[model samples]
Target: MTSASEPDGRRQGASAVADVLKALIREVPDFPEPGIQFKDLTPVLADRHGLAVITAAMAEIAEGADLVAGIDARGFLLGGAVAHRLGIGVLAVRKGGKLPPPVHSETYTLEYGTATLEIPADGIDLAGRRVVIIDDVLATGGTLAAARSLLAASGAEVPAAAVVLELPGLGGREKVAPLQVTSLQTV
Candidate 1:
């Protein structure tokens, strides 16, 4: 069990870690399209100390989760590490048509068009399992919202969502209002 002083100490340590991560993040202009500034975390992932800080913070927030539902690609990076730290399994939330069998899906509005995400029904047996949805960025919250719905619809207990960064202008929190949302950095 952690002592009373542990939480504060952890916060201080996590903040230091965030500083290192922030420094490693690269500013990539017009990535995937034009008129968009992307904060690439690839460098952060490459840094051992940065990764340790992030994983520790994630594990702390994931205190009671039975499973970590990682939302495709980048989420897998954070989720895989967090799952290892927490000694839990990871359920992948993938783009539509990617799963092999008995998949469940949810669709949401995208900046251009509608997008769909899928999760295998047997992935995490939602019956009474505690779930934490993780993603790399919370831009419009459409993907994460869909992921959360898919998890809940599949019978998983989704109480919270986690992300490395969140764009407040996009109202990502409102999109996943049914569940608590946490982000390491806000932009």
Candidate 2:
């Protein structure tokens, strides 16, 4: 329902979301290590319009999904907001060890090491469900890929993924090849 209008009377979903993020995203050089310019989205998510615009846009991209699988950390924010707006349930795909036993886990490589993502295996029946993976940023796509694999293992159909920001230079999009990724903004 939240869309940005252009002079041509057309809606610019990604452009509108990008405009909001460009105004609020914080940039930090050499974060977590040297030569890394970190795009901190704290300010963006904190702002009312920023959050609303992104949530609405992502919800549109995740249309037709029966369930929303929010990746660990920031993904939870948008996932919950979108799912609520769409009147759907949000499944928390937490970090490794965050959930109790009987969780489906998928491991992926990071820049320095490896990380794991998990979801409750017994409580939820993901089989035959259409799921959309939501996350705050798509940097390298490892997390997104892992989430897709984890969800698919549960017999869910991961048709697509949505993210607030994408660092294209990092090859995140290419890393998740075959998985359509809709990003609100790229910087």
Candidate 3:
């Protein structure tokens, strides 16, 4: 019986829910590799609305994202749902050795020389497609930036990147300044 404009208390509750979810995120020291304090989103993902709210926010920011590219691992969880909401395709940007034959790859600098990312040529047709890269955290921005480059090589247009959390102090923002970046929670 409520009008569309009428504030649905339930829907309005999403923000509050997001705040708590943000709090639930745990910091794991030296995970996946040393000197990296990974922002573990598993706890947040376990909550129903936590995941729903995150996906909805990412979708809203994506606006006209024709495709959603999730950087391997955690990125998949967010990207898959956002792709569903947008009724578009999802692309997976994986580690060097993950993709099968006919894959496109790009290499970016690490503290060392470089690291590589790959995307299956058949994963998604990037010709004239506009994609939004999604990830759980924007740390050094190397992975996300590399993913963007890989998508472009496939002939896709990447207008933005979205993450659940962004570590502002890490200079990740400066690395991706050219792209529209959005994070539900920034630290």
Residue-wise C-alpha lDDT for candidate 3, range 1-187, written one tens digit per residue: 0111111223433355357656788889999799977877898888776777677777777769888999888898788988998898888888899878889989899866798899988746789999899999887788888898888888999998888888898788788778878777776
Model 3: residue 8 alpha-carbon error in angstroms: 8.9
Distance from true position, residue 31, model 1, in Å?
2.4
lDDT of each: 0.79, 0.87, 0.79
Q: Give the winner by lDDT: 2 or 3.
A: 2
Off by over 4 Å in 3: 1-18, 29-38
TM-score of each: 0.89, 0.92, 0.84
For residues 1-187, write the lDDT of model 2, one tens digit per residue. 2454342335666556677888999999999689988899899888887777777788888889999999879999889988997899999999999999989899999988999999998989999999999998898889999999999999999999998888898898898899999887777
lDDT of 1 by residue, 80-176 (tens): 8888888999888899889887878899889799988998776356777899987888887889888888888877888888787888998888888
On the 0 to 100 scale, the lDDT of residue 23 in model 3 is 74
Question: Whole-model lDDT for model 1 versus the true structure?
Answer: 0.79
In candidate 3, which residue pairs clash? none
Better of 1 and 3 by TM-score: 1
With a 3 Å backbone cut-off (N, CA, C), the pairs that clash in candidate 1 are 126-155, 126-156
Error of 1 at 123 (Å): 5.9
| Weakest ten-residue segment in model 3 by summed lDDT | 1-10
Please give the lDDT score at residue 112 for candidate 2.
Answer: 88
Supply the global lDDT for candidate 2: 0.87
